[model samples]
Target: MIDILYFAWLRERIGHGRERLETTAPTVAALVEELRARDERHALAFADIAALRVAVDQELTDFDAPLKGAREVAFFPPMTGG
Candidate 1:
């Protein structure tokens, strides 16, 4: 099972803080596709990939990054340091 977390507008759109999913996806992109296919909420949440930032196991990564052995994935906007 993989733990998927949502932040900011993503959480608001999906109406979920997090979810634990059993998936057969090999990459983050694939996982995203699977999630997006689940429902309208997920589709809306992932509609703009450019507006999303992903973290795998708490480390920032690309959507094409491999998901092997990853326990957690988080989706959020780019963090602005001021």
Candidate 2:
């Protein structure tokens, strides 16, 4: 299982901050597709991939990144400078 975390508005939209998912997804993008297919909340949260930033094992990564042995994945809006 992998831990999937959602931050800020993503969390609000999904109605949960985190979840442990058991998936056979090969990449971040595939993982997202799996989640999106689960419910409307997930679909809406991932509606705009361009507006989202992803992290794998706490390190920033792209949606195409491989997820062979990743333990954690997080999604959130792109950071803005103060």
Which candidate should be chosen as best, given lDDT against the real structure?
2
Candidate 1 global lDDT: 0.95
Model 1 misplaced regions, further than 4 Å: none
Query: Please, what is the TM-score per model?
Result: 0.96, 0.98
Q: Write the per-residue lDDT of candidate 2 for residues 20-41, one digit (tens) a residue.
A: 9899999999999999999999
Q: Put down candidate 1 lDDT per residue, 28-75, tens digits, no spaces.
A: 999999999999999989988888999999999999999999999999
TM-score of 2: 0.98
Report per-prediction Cα RMSD to one decimal. Answer: 0.7, 0.4
Task: Give the lDDT of residue 34 in candidate 2.
Answer: 98
- Worst 10-residue lDDT window for candidate 1 reads 44-53
